[model samples]
Target: MKTKITNLQPGMIVGEDIYNLKNSLNLKKGQKLDRDMIDLILKSDITEIEIMDSNASIGFIQKTFEELPNIIDETIYNKWIDSISDLFHHFTKEEIYVSLNNITEEIYKSLNVKEYFVLNFINSFGNDSLTYHSLNTAIIVSIIAKKIEIPYIMYKQTVKFSLIHDIGYAMLDDRVINDFDSDDKNALIHNIVAYKKLQDLKATLNHEILESILYHHERYDGKGKFHLKGEKIPPLVRITQVADAYTSLTELGYTPYQALSWILKKCGFIFDPYYVGLLYEITGYYPTGTKVKLSDGSIGIVLRRNEIEFFPEVLVNNEPVKTGPDSNVYIKEVIE
Candidate 1:
């Protein structure tokens, strides 16, 4: 029978392994629940457990993309969500060639469609932070790659790198992987683990793709593990770093605008200046699909951006509101 962790009895048997946010097994099947074990589960942020029974269903990780769309462009967002989910699973299973086919289709579809990039990302966010990070990173990478004029092949490869760059977390200890800081020893160790696993998998890969995944955590200012600085880091790696950091910041209680602002501020110090500029150019301060309050106390959803980062066209009560210095109305605050 399914039971809450607080309601679990001392002798109840675990029906199946329970996984953490990283998809690592936290509790093994058939383990008997005790007060101490229950205490551990509570501290781990886990809330539910299954008691063994003939009628009880085994637990499994549900796909994040299995849902109806909620954005302005539902069709395109749905395709991107499914493609990211498919690409993520393909890389997790080490099916590199198959993932290429899926990514190619995603890039091709995204070429003519320019408006849904941020909306697609926001729609794909879920409870699984790792999966959300991977998907959002991939989408943002693809968008920035196009603006930087990277060729189709390299673009596809970069998306793949973003999707599986953190796969090493699964191999590391759950305690360390959940911490979310590169200063932690386990974080750097996972980067090496992920790189070595890619090589050991025997999957055909470009040398640069492997390098990018291996060094995605490296800082542009020679501050990271290998102390590689500036041009020493691969351009794709730098791009991936910006995207990865953006996703991490957004997941850690930073609003989209706040996260972008943080990334811009860290430019040249932590991230590559050129790529950070590209991120600002792509997502802007007021990204599409977000609501903001005007100086006149009006609410609106951002529709599109212009040359000015703060000035964007917004839909206010189903009417278009132009905001900039020239107009009396300007964005006062972003609606959280």
Candidate 2:
């Protein structure tokens, strides 16, 4: 039966896969409807959906909403990672662009009004492989794009650029690619190589996108590989640089809070202060998911940031505790 969202009720089963306006999957077929799921549907543009007949639950054991994971669809996410890995192994400009577009669409669906939860979920995990790193950086770039309120078209282009910004790394020797401190000359030329590889597709790609990938290695203080300093670097490229660095640092075992703190210390020396400020604004003083010790000698995970500067809601003993002027407890130190 086709039913309007207002008609949805608990225990109702989805008759077909439901997607959002961008064609990203929202709910899977056969999922038993719950209050939270109904609310999610209501929040989206989807007005009506197919629901299973009332007799469909012959042997069904409905799962509670709490049992469902609120993260991105794992199947889609893993497929995207594999798609990126395949692109690295076999380079095709057209196919790569299509894949990126699809991935961005899914990202939009995942982040819809769930920015804080989604961002915290992403920051809580880390992977050192190039494929995962590329995807992670792209997601971070998307978050920053949302924070800055860039035009939708430009946001898409920026995210696509980030998805393959390190394609040149795939061309390097395995040993060099794996060694973070590699002194080999090939390590220094990955950006140039990536630029040249994409240079042929200029008709399909804009100059800013290509240049952003090319000069991503350039530092703000005129000390990078090409020494292109300050405003000489493209604005989008500056954003990418910050995202790339933060992702890389976290992959190297730095917590999100630690990575942001490291980036803050660099300021204008290694990064543009303006862009760095934007990064801080989105992630807050202590990013969500960071484990910290409180003034009362209890450990808690940051739940979310509040209006207060340094205080965020924390989850301790399975209960939320707000830390700020009103609460006696406050975060004392990060748990590394």
Candidate 3:
């Protein structure tokens, strides 16, 4: 029962617990795969398959987790980064691409727009980094917007800007971005550096999108390194700036619930309370892939949840468990 998400190609047998997508839907599991299901998942935004094959049992993830605390070790960080970048490159190459077109809409039909949005972020991020800091940042923005119940399309645009937010990185060497710089000119480096590189991608970036990325680091206190702070800040720039900061935290290991708690406590100091609340609503108490312990002493991974509610579609004991007609299990604790 190997339950690690790694390289997944077609023709792979899958009967064990696994995540799948149907028209931009989030990952679901335990469903046997025929050719059509296989093709549909392949075409969706599924970046990783936690289950190896159908013959394997679902409880493998927990057994593996208890034995090996880190199924994904240090080497996994780079692998995840690469996987993310490649996913964006693959989809954005041709069309705007929609991960789940409408099935999720049916699942959460009664949920508020914000909850729907948080689901969207979890579903979207299920793919690899694709654009690293940028795409992840976009996801954070989407999450925040969902929390606040902003229109899905508006936040979706925010995500678009985020995905290509640093598309310019495509043109530069690791030295320019993945390194630290002196405070003086370094303040201006992040965006200017990225903006300059985007020029080479042949992308059709507009002023707003470019400016958002260009000024993502600026603040409203007028003390930002780039110094384009205060009212001089554009709305999108301010939005992306905080979204980027918050997303960085999640990427570093904070759960969406933990992050939302911190944001609520620190809002108005390091971040705007209005937007902070918005982001809090976007991530929900849990997002997909978050591992939790059930009251019965078994553990599961959260796969889906609305921003407003606290429960999610989780895989208990590594076996896929849905919160639908068959089960009545509730979460006990998250595997921090």
Ranking by TM-score: 2, 1, 3
C-alpha TM-scores of all predictions: 0.68, 0.71, 0.49
What is the clash count for each candidate, in the order shown? 0, 0, 17
lDDT tens digits by residue: candidate 2, 23-53: 2225546555545457667888888999887
Give the clashing pairs for model 2: none
> What C-alpha lDDT values do all the predictions have?
0.63, 0.68, 0.47
Candidate 3 residue-wise lDDT, 35-134, digit = tens: 3334445676655554544345331111112321231233433444454455445533333233322211321232344334322222112222224455
Number of the top-ranking candidate, with TM-score as the measure: 2
Segments in model 2 whose C-alpha atoms lie over 4 Å from true places: 1-71, 118-128, 173-184
TM-score of 2: 0.71
RMSD of each: 8.4, 16.9, 14.3
Off by over 4 Å in 1: 1-96, 111-127, 173-181, 289-291, 318-320, 325-328, 333-336
Ranking by lDDT: 2, 1, 3
For residue 31, give model 3's deviation from the true position in Å.
33
- What alpha-carbon RMSD in Å does predicted model 1 have with respect to the real structure? 8.4
Give the runs in model 3 whose Cα sits over 4 Å from its true position.
Answer: 1-133, 139-157, 175-188, 196-204, 220-222, 227-232, 253-266, 319-330
